[model samples]
Target: MSFSLRPQPARWFELLTAREDLTLAVETLARTGAVELETHSETATPLVLPDLRGRLEEYNRLAQHYQHYWPQDELRPSNLPGRPVDTFNHALQRLYAWRDAADAVVRRSEALRGELYELEMLREMLLAQGDTPLDLGLLAGAGPALAARLFVLPPRTHIAQIPAAILHTSVHGKVHDFLLAVGPPAEVDLLEQELTLHKGRPMHLPPWLQRGTDASLAALDQRTAAIQAEQRVLEQQLTALQEEHRLVEALGDIARLEWFLTHVEALPVSETFAWVTGWTSDLDGKVLQQALDRAQVRSLLRFPDPPRDKVPPMVFHNPWWAQPFELFARLLGTPARDEADPSRLLVFIVPLMFGYMFGDLGQGFVLLLAGLLLGRRVPTLRLLVPGGLASMLFGLLFGSVFSREDIIPPLWLHPLDQPLLVLAIPLLGGVLLLLLGLLLNGIEAYWRGALRDWLAMDAALLLIYLGGLGLLLTPYAALAALTGLFWYLGARLQRAGGDLRVLGGALGRLLEYTMQLIVNTLSFTRVGAFCLAHAGLSVAVVGLAEAGGHPLLSAIILLLGNGVIIILEGLVVSIQVTRLVLFEFFIRFLRGEGRRFQPLPAPPHKTERT
Candidate 1:
C-alpha cells in the first residue's frame, strides 16, 4: 500500500563541455536542479575564482548591512525577479555604486555614534560630581600641583577617618557616592591606599573639561542632540534602499554562481574541454542536455554505472497522500540507497495505532477540524487528518461520546470492560509489526547481496515468530528452534573466515538478537495501557461531574473535564504514537543512514513576458 520498496532510480552521468562554455553549462545544470555534481569525484577539481570570491564577500557584507531594513514576510514569486541576471562586469558596476552610497552613510553614522558615546560619558561623569559648588575648570587646574582626585566610596566607608590636612567633600548616593579630595602628591598617594582598603574606586575627569560642570553638561547635551538628528537622517537613507531589494538579490545570485564555479571540481578531459561527472535521473539528464543545446553550449552526456565506492543518492517515490509521512522518515534520516522507503508504511501504521488508543468520536471530530485548518499551513500536521478519522472510527466501535459510554450501545468491547483484550491486542499487533520488519529486512538484505544477514538473523527470526504464532504445527516450532540455534552458532563459523576466537562475539550477538526480539514485542503493550488509561480518566471525570450538587455545576464540570481530556490527553497520545512508530517500528529495519542528495541551487524564477 506504500512506496516502501519503490524509490526513484537515478543513473550516473558525465557531461563534457568546452572550457569557454563551462559557466553556461554549470549555470544550466544549476537552473534545472536535476544534476548533483560529484564534488568529491576525481574529475571534480576546485576552480580558481579570485574575482568571484571578492565579489561574494562584498555582497555578503552588504546583505548583512541592510538585512534589518528588508521588509518581513513580503510576497515574492518563486522565479527570478522580472529583470535578467546581470553579467559579472555589470553586476560589479552596480555593486560598486551601491557600496559607495552605503559606505558614505555608514561612515557618517559611525562618526555620530562615536561623538554621541563621548557626550554620554561626559554627561554621566559630570552628573556624578553631584551639586558641587566648585567650578569643574578650577577643579581640573587644582589637580596640577597637589592633585585634586574624585573618589567613589561605598556608603559604609568612614570618610571622617581621612587626614584632615586633605581638603575633601562627600555626596551620598544609592550604593556609593563621590568624595572630591585634594592634597600634596605624596599625601594624596598615601590617602589613595587607604581608600582601596575601604572598597573605594577613583574616577578621572575627561580630557575635554575646560569649564564648570553645569556649563560642560549643557554643551555636551547640545552636541548629543545634533549627532542624534544626523544619525536619524543616515538611517532613513539606508532604509530607503529596501525598495531596491531585487538588485541586491541579483548581486547575491551572481556572487554565488561564481563561488560555485570556483569550488566545483571538474576534470579537464582535453586541452579545450572540461567535464563534470555526477548522478541524475534519466529524464533530468535529458532536460539538462536540452538546456545546454539551447544556450549554444557544446556538451556530451553519457550514462554509466557508478563506481563501487559511490552510493547513489536516495529519492523517495511515494503517492501524494504518503508524501507528508516522508517528512517523519526524513527526520530520523534518509533511507540508504539500497534500503526500503518506509514513508508509506509509516502512513498506514502510525495512524492506525493512534486511532486504536485515542478512540473518541467527539474529540476526534475536533481533531479532524484542527488538522484541516493547520494542514494548509503546516505540512507535517497534515498527517493528523487521517489519524483523526481513524480515531473517530474506533470511537464509533467503542460506543463512547465525550467520555459518556452509556450514551450509545457498544459496537465493540469497551477498554475498561476487558482490560486483558486491550493489552493482548497491542502485543499481537506489535509482534506482527516486528515480523513485517524482519520480512522487509530480509528482502533488503538479499537485494544488497548480504546473504549472511538475510538467512542468519532475519530468516531465522521469521520462522521463530511464526512458530510462536502457532503456525506450521509442532514441526514449525522444532524447525524454529533449530534455525535459531544454527544462527547462534553460524556467527562463529563466519567470523574472520571461521576463526575459533570469534566464538565469543558470535555468542554475544545471539544474545543481543534474542533480547531485542522480546523487548521490541513487549514495547507495544503501552498502546493498550494508554487506551485503558484514557477510558479510566474519562470515567473519573464523569464521576466528578455527576457528584456536583447542582445540575448547572455538573454540566460545567463535565464540559471542562472533557475539554481537558481532549486537549491534554490528545497531545500526550500523539507523542506516544510517534514514539512507537519511530522506535518500535522504524528502528527495526529502517537504516536511515543515507546522505541526502543536494542539487545545485537554481536561479530565481524568471517572470513570463506578456
Candidate 2:
C-alpha cells in the first residue's frame, strides 16, 4: 500500500537582505532550523561575479585550443580527462579538429600514391611497346593466329610465302604476334600413291621493350615509400601535441575546483548566500523539500501555500515491477488507485512464471549463473536474481536436466510427459491471486471510507469468488446461497429500492466485475503455455544435437540451444511475468501516485558543527 502526500507552502529569506534587526532575528531563528523567513528587497546584490567572469574567460581560451586540435567531433571519452563542463567542451573541439587534420593528411597521401602508381604503369606500357615502327594493322590481322598457336610476338615485322606460292605479311607486336598459312598443300606422287605435303616456317623475335618498363616501376616505388614515411612523421607529431593538450585541460579542472573553494570561503558570516532562486505558481512545499534534500541543506523557503488537491505522491520503490505498470497508466491517461503492493506481487509471480517457462535444471543453472554475473556488473539485473532462483527451483520440481527427464524421477509431473498438471498449477495460481486482489480491494475501500464501494464492488467480488470455489469443490446449492447473498448486498449498496437507474448501475457494475474475474483468471494461462514452450524448445535442442553426426557438432548444438533459451525464452518469460503483475495484480490493488518527502537547506558552517 502507498501513502498520500500533503503539500504545503514555505518561503525562506536570508538575513543578508534584511535590516540589521531582522537579520539578527533570522540568524537567531536559523540556529533552530525550524522557522521559515520572508524578506522583500528593491534590488538583489550580485554574488560571485568576479569568479564567474574568470571561469568564463578560462572556458573561452580552452574552447579556442580545442578548435585547433579537433575540427570534427570524433574523439572518444577515454581521450579526454576531467569533468569541468567548459573545459570538456573545449577539449572535444580540439580533438575533433586534430582528427580532421589527420584524416585530410592521410587522404591526400593515399591519392598521391595512387596517381603515382597509375603514371608508373602507363610509363611501363609505353616502354614495353619499343621504338619499332611496326605496322599495327598487320598485327591486328595476325592476332587471332597468334592466340590459336599460343605464341609470343617480338616488336618487329616479317613476311612469309604460303604453299600456294602467294605472299602473306606477318607483324610482331609488343605482347604477341603470328603468321597465317592460308594456302592448300601441294600433292606429290611417290611409291605408287599420291601424297600431299607442305612445310611451315617459324621465326623468333627477342623482347627488348620489357627492360625500360622495369626501370620506371622501380623509380615510382621509391618515390611512394618516401612520401609514406613523411606522412607517418606528421601523424606522430599531431598525436603528441593532442596528448599534451589533454593533460593541460585536465590540470585546468583542478584549478577551477581551487577557485570555487576560495570563493566559497570568502563569503561573509551571518550573511545569507542564495544558491538558486526561482518562481512558480504551483510550487509545493514537497518540491522545496526535495530540492533541499538533494542539496543536503536544512534551510529552505518558498512562497504561497502548496496545492491541497488530493493526488497521490510518485514513488518508485520497485522499478522493475512498477515501470511496466506506469507505462500502462500513461496509455490509459487517467488516475487510478492500486492499493496492493506491486513489489510483493512481482516477488511472487515473476520467478514462479519464469520457473514454469524454463524448467530444465542444467539450463536453469546456466541462466542463474549468467544472471548472477551480470547482476554483479549491472545494477539493473539485480531484480532478476529471484526470478533465476525460481526457474532453478521449478526445474528441480519438474525433474528435468537439459530437457531430459531421465536424469531424475518425476517429483510432480514433467511438462511434456504430463500436460494436465502443467495446466492445473497455473489455473490454481490465477484463481488464488484474483481472490487475494478482491480481499485487498475490500480492505482498501473500507479504509478509504467508501463503504458503498467496499460492500458493492469488493464484498460482491468476494462472494462471487467464494461461490465459484464452493461450486468447484462441492455442489450447486452452496454456490446458489453465496450468489443470493452477493446480489442482496450489491443491490442494497446501489440503493436500488425502486429506481431503475440505481438498479441498472448495480447490474452494470456486477457485469463488469464478472468480466474482470474471467479476464484475470485467463491471464494465468500463459504460465502453462510458457511451460510447454520451455519443454518443447529443450526437446528441439536435443533433437538437433542427435541429428548432427559429429561429437563436436553435438556439443556446438547444446551450446547454441542454451544460448537461445537464455536470451530468447528468458526475455519472453520476463515480459509475460511483468504483464501478469501489472495488469492482473495491480489492476486489483495498488495506488502509486504519491509525492516523495523532501527536506530543506542548511548552512555550510552549521553542517560542520553537526
Candidate 3:
C-alpha cells in the first residue's frame, strides 16, 4: 500500500507467448488484473481468425428479440476447454440450433394466446344473451356456405327502418342496436346487401363455433385449454433445448469474448510469437508471477527499467481507513509519479478542520448516523463518520450540544468566551501546516533528484517563513533578516548558469511568494472565525426559541434551528475545509501529471486458475 507520501509505484513489463497460447496467456494476465496490455495491432500484422462479426451481430439481434423466451437460468460468460475464437463460433452455432428448434413453436404459441383472448370475450358476450336454451348453430351457422353474422345498427338508423325480410334477432341498446342474421348462402348475401342500405356492420366469427349452446360454450373452454396445453408443450420443448445447448449462458460468454478479442487483436504479432508490453503495480507483478506459474501457460514475463523518456502509469493504494479520502486528491488530478500524494495527510486534516468549524455533539451524532446509513448509496457521505467523530470530540472540548453550552463543562475555553486565543492558535497552526507542506515539496523534489534546485527556492522560503514567525512572537528580527539574506544569495546561486536572471524575475516571484506565504498563514483565522459563527448562530437559535414562549413552539423552533445549523453550517464548513486543503494546503506541493494505471478488463469470476 502507498502508506507513505508517494503514490503506488508501477513498473514496466513485457509478456511473450506462443501464437497459439496467446489467448490463454492473456487470459491469465487479465484475470489476475496485473497488467495493462498495450495495443500495437494498428502497426502489427493482425491475426487471421474466422470472421465471427456476422455471427455476433446475429446473436445480438436474436438475444434482444427472444430475451423473454430464454430459459430461466443464471447467465454468465462461459470458457470452454478450447480456443478463444472457437468460443464465439461454438456459442453462435448453439444459439442458431436453439433458435431453429424453438422458433416455430414459440410463434404459434404466441399467436394461439392472442386468439384465446378474443374467443374468451365472445364467450362472455354469448353468455350475456340470457339463460333461455337456444341452438347457437341457428345464430352461428348450420353449414359452411350458410352462415350467420352479428351487426351493430346505429341509434339514428330508426330514421330508416330495417328490412323485415332479413331473418334476424335484434337487441336495442342506448347508442346502437345489435342484430344477428342467419340464412342460406344466397339469402345471407342478399341480407347483407339489403342491410348495407341501413348501415348495419357485421361482426364475424368462425363457422366452427356454430355448435349447440352447451357444445359451443364447451368449445370455447376447449379452445382455451387447448391453446394453454400447446403452449406448455412448446415451453417444455424450449426448456429441453435451452438446457441441452445452454444457449443463453453461452451467448453471455460469447458477448464477453467479443470485447476480449479487441485487445487480443491489438497486440503486435510475429509469425510464431505474440508479444505485448505495458505497466502494472509492483505487487501485481508478484501476484501475476504466482498466477502464471499456477496456470502453467506457455508464456514468458519480464520487468525492465522503465524507459526514461516515458512516465510509468500510477496506481495509488491506501489503508481502508484512508481510502475514502483519496477522493480529495483525485479532485486535482493524478499526482506526477515522483510527486507526493496529499491524500494520506488529508485524512487527518479534512476532519480536523471540518470538526473545528462544525462542533456540536448532538448534530455530530446525527451526521454520523446519516453517514452509516447512507454511505453505501452516496459515496461522498463516507467522510461524515470521521468528521462527525472529530466534531463530537471537539464538541466535548467546547462543551456544546445542539447549541446548548451549559450541558457540559468546558474542557477547553469556548470560542465565544476566548476569541483571541481561538484565533491565535489557528494562525500559529497554519504556519506549521504551511511549513510541513513545504517540507513535503522538498521530499518530492528529492525523489525527482532535484533537491539541489529545491533548496535554492522552497527550502529558503520555508526557513524565511519560520524565521518571520519567530520575529513576530519573540525578539528574533535578526534571524528573520538572516533568512532574507539567504534567499537573495540562493536566488543568485540558482540563476548563475544563465538559466534565470535573479534581479529580473526571481526577486519579483520571491517577493510575491513571500507575501502569499504570509497571507496563507493568516488565512487560518477563518477556522476560528467559523467556530465563533457556529456558536453565535446556535445562541441566536436558543434566543429565538425562548422568544416564542409556547412550549411546543419553542421545541419546534429548536429542532428547526438545529436542523438548519447542521445542514447549512455543516455544508458551509465542508466547503471551507475543501478550500483550505485545495488552495492553502495542496497548492504547496502537488503537481498533477501522472497517468492512472488501467489494467485489462477480465471475466468477473476467477476462471483461469487451476
Candidate 4:
C-alpha cells in the first residue's frame, strides 16, 4: 500500500492575557515551539513596541568585533543549559557597559599604534640617507625663510640643467637622490611640482635635522624605543578582552529574542488585556493551554479552521521502512495539501527501473556491500540495498554471473540476445506509469474540487492513453472521445470570455500532452540499451583478456575490467533511473507547492558533549 501525507492541520486561536502576565505568556509560547504567530491588531498600523532595536544592533556590532576571540566550546558561562533566564534589562546594561569600556581601550590602542607606525616610517627614511656624506646641521641652520626638500629621481630622467639652489646630488642605483634648498614657500612648491612632472618621487622631510647623519639616526632610535614600549602595553590590554567572548555571545542571544518580541503585534483589547493570535498543531494545542495555565495567566483557546490564505505548513508522516525515500521526494518539493506524496511510489519503481538497466550478479553484490559499508556514515545511501537486491534477481533471470554468459544457463533470454523483447518491457512500463500518473492527477483534482481538471483534461488524457495502447475496444472510439473533449474545452474557454487565440492555446495543450506520452515512452528505451551495453562492454573486456596470451595477465585484466564496469556502469544506471522517475514520472502528477513545516528556534549548538 502506498503511504502519503498532506499538509498538517492547524487550529487558529486567540489568547487574552493580563498586561502583567504578558512576558510569561510570550515566553511559554516560544518555549512550546508550536505556534506560528500572526499579526493581531484591529487597525492596520502596528502598535509601538519596546525600544530594543538599538540594543540588538549594538550587540551585533560588538559580537562581530570580537568574533575572532570567541570561545570555541559549548559550555558558555552565560547561556549554559538548565540555567535560569536572566532579565533583559540587566543583561542589556551589563553588555552596554562592557562594550563602552572595551571600545575606549581599543580606540586608545589604535591611536598609539598609528603614532608608532609613523615614527617607524620616519626612521627608515632617515636611515636611507646615512650613506650621504653631508652636514645635516647646515641645512637646519639655513633659517626659517629657507627650506630644503629631498627628491628621489629615477635613473631614466637626466638633469642636464641644474639650479644653484641644489645643494647635493648622489646616485643610489637606478634612483638619483637630490637635496635642494629653496628660499620662501612659493619657490619650494614650484620646485616640487617641476620634479613631479619629471616622474621624480618626493620624500617627506622630518622636523628634526641636527649635526651629521649619524647623530640624527641615534635620535630617531631613541624615540622609536619609547613608542614600542607603549605599543606593548596596549597589545596586552586588547588580548585580555578575549576572555570576555562567552559573555558577549550570551548577551547576543538575549538581545535577539527581545528584538523579535518587540516586533510581534498583539491586539489591544483593553487597557489591561491584549489578545495574541496564532496557529498551532493539533498535538501542541493542549500542551500550549497547559503551559498558559501553569503560568497563572487567564486565557481562552479556540480551534477554528484556518482561512484560505493561511495554509498550514506540511509535515510528511511515513512508515519507518519508507522514511528514507522521503529525502528524494523533498528534493523535488513538498507536495500540495491535496496532492499525492511520491515517496512510496518511488520506493517501488526506482529499484525496478535501476535493476533492469544494470543487471549483473557480481556487480549487484558489490553494490550491496558498498551500500551497507557506506551506510555507516550516511544513513540515506543505505536505501541502495533494495536496488542492488533487485539487480541480482534480474541477473538470475538473465542467467549471467560476472557478465560471463558461459558461467550460467539462461532462464530467460539475455539482454543482447533479444533486444526487441528487452526494449518492449521498459516501453510497456512507461505507458503504464503514464496512465497511473493521469489517474492520480484526476483523483487529486477531484479531491480539491477542481471539476474542470478532474472531469475534463485529466479524464480525457487517461482514457486516450489506455485507448491508444489498445487496452480499449478500438482506436477510433478513443480518438472520437478525445476530439469531443477538446471541442468541449474550447467552447468552455470561449464562454468564459476567451478569444480565438486562447482556444487555439487550449487545443495546443492537448496536442502537447499527446506528444509527451509518445516521447516519454520512447525515452525509457535507455533502460534496455544500457543493459545491452553492459553485456557488450563485458564481452570486450573478455576479448582483451584473451588477446593477452598469459593466464595471469588475462585474469588480472578481467578483474580490473569488471571492477571499472561495476563502479562506472552502476553510477550511470542510477542517474538514468532517477532522471526518468523524477522528470518523466513525478512531474506528470505531482504538484509540489506546499511549504515545509518549521518549529521555533532550536537550542544553541554545543561543541562539547558535557
Best by lDDT: 3
1-610 per-residue lDDT for model 2 (tens digits): 4332112223332323222122122223333433332222322243333343465565456556443433233322221122234443554455455455555655565565665554444344435544434433233244322311112233343323223342333434444343422221221112002111222223212122223435434554666577678757755766675675563443333333334333322223234333232222122345435434443343445443323432333333343544333333332232233343344444566677778877777777777777678876875566566666777788788888877677887677778877877887898998888887677677666656786767754576677766766676788847664775557555655565656556556657667777778888988988998899888888888889889999999989978887888888888887887688668866776554433322222222311111
**Which sections of candidate 3 miss by over 4 Å?**
1-3, 16-28, 39-48, 71-73, 109-235, 262-265, 269-276, 282-284, 290-300, 306-310, 374-379, 493-505, 541-561, 604-610
Model 4 residue 27 CA deviation in Å: 8.5
Which candidate has the highest TM-score of all?
Answer: 3
| lDDT value, candidate 3, whole model | 0.76
**Local lDDT at 238 for model 1:** 73
* Cα RMSDs, all models: 8.2, 16.9, 7.7, 9.5
- Across 514-610, the per-residue lDDT of candidate 1 in tens digits comes to 6878888898999999999988998998899999989999999989998998789888998998788777777777878777767766644321111
lDDT of each: 0.71, 0.52, 0.76, 0.66
Comparing 2 with 3 on lDDT, the higher-scoring candidate is: 3
Better of 1 and 4 by TM-score: 1
> Clash pairs of candidate 3?
none
Candidate 4, residue 159: Cα displacement in angstroms equals: 26
Give per-residue CA lDDT, model 3, range 443-552, as digits (tens). 88888899988887677777777777777768776577577656766667657864555565666777798899988988999998999899999999989998998999
Model 4 earns a TM-score of: 0.59
In model 1, where do residues sit more than 4 Å from their true spots?
1-9, 14-35, 58-89, 98-276, 281-303, 307-309, 327-333, 376-378, 406-408, 449-461, 471-515, 547-568, 586-588, 592-595, 601-610
- TM per model? 0.64, 0.53, 0.75, 0.59
Tens-place lDDT per residue, model 4, 1-610, is 2335344445676677765444445556666677766643333234444455565666567667754334444423232222112344455565565566567776776666666665554455456556555555466456467766666566557665545554445444322444444456567667678778888755545456556667777776776687678768766765565444334445444643553455455445445666676666544478888876665565666666655566677666666766677776677778777778767776788888888877877777877888788976998777678778878888887876777777887678788889888988898888778777777776677668896755655666666566566634565676755665665575558566876657667767777887888788889888888888888898888888888899999999889998998888988987898788777888787867877655544233311112
Clashes of each: 8, 43, 0, 0
